[model samples]
Target: MSQKFPEVQGGGSLIIAWQVKEKNVLVVGGGERGIQVAAGRILHALNADARVTVVCPSSGLNDEVAFRIAEKQVSHIDRNFEPQDLDAADMVLCAVDDPEASTRVWKLCKERRIPANIADVPSECDFYFGSVHRDGPLQVMVSTNGNGPKMASIIRKKIAGTLPDNTGAAIENVGLLRKKLREVAPDLKDGAKRMKWMSRVCESWSLEDLVEMNEADMSQLLDYYKSGEVPSLKAIRDTQ
Candidate 1:
């Protein structure tokens, strides 16, 4: 008999890791609170490699926004949002203090089928920005479905504290090893073997061991893989 599966109960937003590299992101803000909100959203968009454009008046800009604009990290439209502004927007973050303007942007985005987040208004948001803890390429996000952002931030901090400082470095080392393994064993038939080797390496080595592995150690790993063996952490590091 097949194993029984647990029943599902769904009532929450779908969490996903979105890759917005080189995509167009529109950030709308105005007034004091709006600019503060816009600054954070702009930073995140830039970090994601999105082509960001902020729509706000000069008076609305905070120091961070002013600095980024001066640095040419993002383009600026020194005016309130217009319907034409949504023309090339792949995604939108609406944080304007003006409720009417926020609603208008949300409505237009809905009609255009662009995903949008209307700050602090769960009903209007197609997605919520969770509190995130980042370490190099690693990112851990916590969400309360836009109900408790402050609580999410607190929880993220707790989680971050428990992780090792060199966790990201270990992950980077493993990634490099994967690439070398692929080059040496570049056959469709060896896919499962490669996966097994990687899994064994991760399981056998401590975080510090993985972090200390250099390019020479990586080459040693490939040598062991060719013989259908996963070497101990000491064995690989000894080659260096």
Candidate 2:
């Protein structure tokens, strides 16, 4: 790892989000690292349907996660990871066999907000992804906080192993119900009222009962807000 890659920053603006959604992605490397990374890049996409292009002369996207990638799949460049790699790429991942080459790629990515990940070393990466679990539109992620990746991996496996299969579905329902609550009241106090509705929804409904919860009430609230009407909470929730 390069000394330039610090454990933490003293004073600098570090980015915490990505620019890719309906955007381009590029990965360079064909070995195990490249293949895994290529798969991951496709996995985290907000718009999992966006196009991704991988350029590694020796390797390409693997079949293991090909179905997921195919849904938002990547195209292969069939060439060595070169400076020209970024020309067509929105973000880059350097999984090359060469450390120096990876470092070089890191420099270019750093110059731009274009997210980059260096497989040879975590410290060199602009950002890293943690193992994630998803249910419908809900997601739970486990990040290492750029500390001990091995420990993070161990914890992630523990989480994934222990989590109930219905956990994600429950969370998704909560999110959907929250949207409904907001719709029912136009001038509901911002913080607690919104959060309170979510709390009530959780308390009132079982994970399985979420599907049976009425969306019409929530929809009516949102519709009232659109019509410039702000109803009281009790009126919206109980009296309708």
Candidate 3:
């Protein structure tokens, strides 16, 4: 099967959210640079139950890789990479310092129809890693499309500083409200009615209000919805 790359818009790279859970990931090289890339992949995979394998000569293995190996978080092959290493890999990271090896890995991955990321070699990479900021269930990623990684990091830091600490909590409360709505207003299952009700609820409750709500407040909100009372748009606007 041929791989379909995402379309570029406005001369910028296309951004996407990929699901890597339970997938096989291959990391070639275990030096300082390679360790950094592998560490990120391992962290992302930890919560998703994905499998990660690192291949690098023992002499090139860094302390970080050694520690992860000792902890049994990822499987490792203490030797140089081989062409067959690309077999069964859903994603591959080529971080070796040798340009020849990196090029070979990239070519093999392309032949096998696997997505590959070659560190510092955007031309040979299928994708580039972006700077990510995660807050509980909320995750924000910033990417410069391999044009400027340092700028992406700076932007990520700026955005992370502006987000409220309770942002994640607010999202969780909204989720709870959604579940209650399904039970309390089953009759409002029609898409329009449901959307309007949800809009009212969202407007009536601010992020701070949602984060500060207790069990009593949640029960009261459910009762209000069950009473089939829709707050007037004027009232919603006034709250805003």
Candidate 4:
């Protein structure tokens, strides 16, 4: 007999981390609010190596936008948005205050099957821009499914405060350890066994311990993995 999965029933937005690297993103607006959104998109593009273009009629730019432009991080077209602008865009952001213009962009995105977000107008958007918290490579985004952005911002701030400062470094160290472990041990070729071993290693070390680990400490960890000798909780805690 086949198993039946439960049907999902909700109006909530599906949160996901999109890979925008080396992709084209279009922002249709360069006003105050639009510039703010464009600034964020540009930063994301910089980190992900994506290409960004902002379409607006005004020469005036916010300080952030101006800096990114000067740094050659983003391109700007000084003109009103045209339907043809959506032609090679992987994603689009409609930040124009004009309802007609926003609707037009939204419709074009839908027709083209491109993901889009219309600033402050959730009804016309395929997605909402949520508040983000970053700790190195760890990124957390919070949203209220377009119902309450202010609330999302508040929650994101609270959550950000709870994260450890060395989260990014710790994650990188773990990646290196994982790579080393795979290379040294051919016996742990089974995916499940590898996962179990990783879980055990993580259980022995706290976030602080992982952050404090240097080259010598990583060498000791590799030794433990090879010898099949798990370090005591007290020994691990002492490093912190």
Tell me which residue pairs clash in candidate 1. none
Give the TM-score comparing model 4 with the true structure, all chains together: 0.85
Give the range where candidate 1 is weakest over 10 consecutive residues by summed lDDT.
1-10
* C-alpha positional error of residue 33 in candidate 3 after TM-score superposition, expressed in Å: 3.0
Q: In model 2, what are the clashing residue pairs, if there are any?
A: 180-218, 183-221, 183-222, 184-221, 184-222
* Local accuracy of candidate 1 as per-residue lDDT tens digits, 78-183: 9989999999999999898989889999999999999999988999999889999988878999999988999999999999999998999999999999998899
lDDT winner among the candidates? 1
lDDT: the better of candidates 2 and 3: 3
lDDT of 4 by residue, 1-240 (tens): 234876777888888888888899987875666667667766765776779887876574778877776787788877889888888899997776677778888888898899998887888888777888877778899999888888999999999898878888888877777787787676645566666777887787788767776666666666667555667545744664
Q: Residue 44 in candidate 3 has what lDDT?
A: 67
The best candidate in terms of TM-score: 1
Global lDDT scores for all candidate models: 0.90, 0.63, 0.77, 0.77
RMSD of each: 1.6, 7.7, 6.4, 3.6
State the lDDT of candidate 2 residue by residue for 113-209, as single tens digits: 6678887477787677666666666555677666666776787777778766676666765677565655555464665666655565566545655
